[model samples]
Target: MASGSPLQPTLGELIASLSLQLTTLVKGEVELAKAQVAEKGKSMGLGIGLFVGAGLFGFFAFAVLIATAVLGIATALPAWLSALIVGVALLLFAGLLAFVGKKSLDKAKEVKPEPVANLKQDIEIVKDGFTS
Candidate 1:
């Protein structure tokens, strides 16, 4: 053996270093993706919360409007009977909507674990390559 530059690395050392760097790169990429997904999830959750809040308020507004309409109708008809008739009709409409919504939900596809599946496939392929 002869003296060499301090910067020089043996073949095995170089390969080890490359492997370490590749591992770091993959870890960094995965972490970055996780962060991005977390951020998007937070935003999506906030948006959904806001929409639900709006929907709740809208439902209350709709109820108030319905009550007003029923009271207006009561000017000619009996107030109690007017309210009962409107309430029955509203219940029927809501029942129809609920049935339709249930059918739609039943027909909807379940959330697929596509990312995890792809990652598993990739790992398997890499494992196979190494084994071969």
Candidate 2:
């Protein structure tokens, strides 16, 4: 009904503006948290990949070393006996590795999502909103 200074707002108008600003801040923070979690998750995946690579490299290196040792032994013995002995040794090694791997796998726990902390605090805030 009346003109007012452009620099000043009525109480209700000021409250509405503050509420909107608060909501924007909350949403911005939520997006930031999501981005940070995604970045960290990517880094964790890289770390796991490096760990697997190290394990595979070690396995291949050990196999190479064993092959070199077996070649040396085969040269000293008769050809037929050397081949048979090496064949049995390799089969036994394979079986033992398989058993150990199975045991380790059986002892592993399945990965599952954990419940997020602070969910109770979020619920409490919502409950207080109804009361207020």
Best by lDDT: 1
lDDT of 2 at 127: 100
The TM-score, computed over Cα atoms with residue i paired to residue i, of candidate 2 is 0.55
User: What are the models' TM-scores?
Assistant: 0.63, 0.55
lDDT of each: 0.93, 0.85
Please report how far candidate 1 places residue 55 from its true position, in Å: 1.9
lDDT string, candidate 1, 1-132, tens digits = 465567898777889999999999999999999999999999999999999999999999998999998999899899999999899999999999999998888777565559988999999999999999
The global Cα lDDT (0 to 1) of model 1 is 0.93
In candidate 1, residue 129 scores what lDDT?
A: 100
Clash number by candidate, in order: 0, 0
Q: On residues 1-132, what C-alpha lDDT tens digit does candidate 2 reach at each position?
A: 365567878777889999999999999999999999999999999999999999999999988876776677779977666667777988999999999998888777454435564677778899999999
Candidate 2 stretches greater than 4 Å from native: 1-9, 97-132
Instruction: Quote the lDDT for 29 in model 2.
Output: 100
Lowest-scoring 10 consecutive residues by lDDT in candidate 1?
104-113
